[model samples]
Target: MMASCVFSRWKIPYLASMYFRGVMRIPSKESFLCSRVMIPDIECSSSKTMWGFKQYHDGRPRGPLWRGKKLIGKEALFVVLGMKRFKDEEEKLQKFIKSHVLRLLKMDMIAVLTELERQEEVSLAVMMFKVMQKQDWYKPDVYLYKDLIISLARSKKMDEVMQLWESMRKENLFPDSQTYTEVIRGFLKYGSPADAMNIYEDMKNSPDPPEELPFRILLKGLLPFPLLRNKVKQDFEELFPDQNIYDPPEEIFGLR
Candidate 1:
């Protein structure tokens, strides 16, 4: 009778656990026991009843996945990140070219040359050019060629610059006033003022020559140390023989 009692006690609990496991769909013996033992301040029930109870108990809301401030959009994020990395105006200019965020070709070309004026990184800039070439959005024009030449010249890769120039000529992309201005500035920056003067002279003979500011870039490169004021006056006189040479408007000086 004692042995019979022990068998009854064990058999009842084992069958109850198995039934619980089946009803709960707990999938494994370990999980079934874990669910039963981990119940907090709760009563154990039949396996068939436990599923609904578990679902009811687990129906509370969890927190959001990302609960911080809202994120900026992709364009804004790129601009903000670029600005943070590069403090210098020139570096920012280069970043704009490298990033291809500009909406217009003229703006992009201007930015590229402006950055090259401060410092040149030909390989990186060329990589940007290659990227531009691949994109259908930015069609390469005379301005692009001119900017590439200027970038190469500033990097002192004169041979490559000349090669690019030749290629431009072969493509029938005639060099414009801006192109000559860039070449002249490049020569002057590299201590080849004679070459710069030759380019300036050639530009003067072109059908459409560059005006004041581009000439100013050439002059600045040529007379970087202490600036030859009289020489500037003489060159301005030669370039604009009829027009009066005076200080421009305050707005033009970027002071207003």
Candidate 2:
């Protein structure tokens, strides 16, 4: 049981397609002040807000601080409870629990990131990235960087995009094919085919096995640039021998 504190009036601007940004620092202690309070058993299908982790939005002045802290607390408690149930080979299970806790921490961070995106809080999301980068558990991954880049690109923050991309490299985490696909998509949407092609060029050198999805997405994105489309089409065919790659309709190429 937890003690009840002031009913936090914190609210995150509810947004459709929200990408939250948060670096959840789960407490190391087993006990929490929020443990005494009963979290309303509101049912939700969102994996991010499971266990009645509803975002409060009473038009409060405070943005997300109150909600994020409480949610992290609940998640920490859940982790502790989950570990207790894994009773057997106590030593081994303890190791498993530690790893799982890190995963939960990651889930919380991603939840916040996505929520922030949904809210269109790009600045906050960028700040959250900085905070996450400093965390001991933070590991740069392609997917994580993908979403961040997309957000930055939409906001036309090219400098931030380049910095993040460079930081990702310095972390010894090269962009994967999917990351290339997304950055290319962002560039296309930003009306910069040249930048998009630059990513495609780098993607050609990625060591990760060639995937059909990135190629397919890039092909769609390249529809406006016939010359570029042809270039990618040739590479797609060469990389995917078992699959059939189709060109856009003749009408798309302005042919009768």
Candidate 3:
């Protein structure tokens, strides 16, 4: 017999070997006009034969953050998002700018700043926020300001937080319900119940009436003072009769 020879369209015959363990052939599955592709290489050692891949080099890295010696990737993104802790806010901010994290798209940058806030890296988050403010293409975004406000509020930087709130208004950008909620929460955190109530009043007067959660949250946040909590408690009860409302513990209201 012909040893069952395999042939291509051009009558190309395979090299038949009785000791052939596995099939082998040149990979032509992927080919481009001018692109590097994974081409397999045959390695034959003293004891065995194996197939390996030759490294594919596509000239150079591509993207905004890709460069000669200062290429940065996911690791840099992690550091920018506060996954890799820094000694101080300035250090983190410097790394963020140096890593070219801001070179990413605006939507991506917003997410990163939000992540920074979630990680409680407020100081650096604030600095990066100012950098964003100075950008010519920067548009007013409620969530961006909200994240920074919450971060600053937690850090007890209420002065700057309110300043941002006022600036948001002057730009004709209104705070959504969730934004109002966070700002109120931040005010409560910083022991500024008066300012918190002012924002709450604004929330109540907003063109769009806020949901019950903000009312409940601000009500709970008013535990330190009996007068305010009682007033909101009634309004909260009136708003959501079917839904159960949780009141702060009596002790929080100075009851034994």
Which one wins by TM-score: 1 or 2? Answer: 2
RMSD of each: 21.0, 20.4, 9.6
**Could you tell me the lDDT of residue 88 within candidate 2?**
43
lDDT of 1 by residue, 1-256 (tens): 9999999999999999887965556434434554757755443333334444432322233432122113333343343335335545766656675564444353443444334333355654554455555556765478778767867776677667767776676666767866776676677667777666666665665566558765676645644332443466577789778766545444644445
lDDT of 3 at 150: 68
Residue range 1-256, candidate 2, lDDT tens digits:
1222222222234331143423343432222322444334432222234343633323334645455554555664444345444544567555754575445566665665655565566655665567566678877677777788777877777768878888877877777665676677777777888887777777776667767877787788778777888888989888787788776587966644
- Clash list (residue pairs), candidate 1: 20-47
The segments of candidate 1 whose C-alpha lies over 4 angstroms from its true place after superposition are: 1-121, 124-140, 219-239, 242-256
Which regions of candidate 2 deviate over 4 angstroms? 1-70, 73-115, 132-144, 153-159, 249-251
Candidate 3 lDDT, 139-162, residue by residue in tens: 888778877886776677888888
Better of 2 and 3 by TM-score: 3
Q: Least accurate stretch of 10 residues (summed lDDT) in model 1?
A: 63-72
lDDT value for model 2: 0.63
> Model 1 RMSD to the real structure?
21.0
Top candidate when judged by TM-score against the true structure: 3
lDDT of each: 0.57, 0.63, 0.66
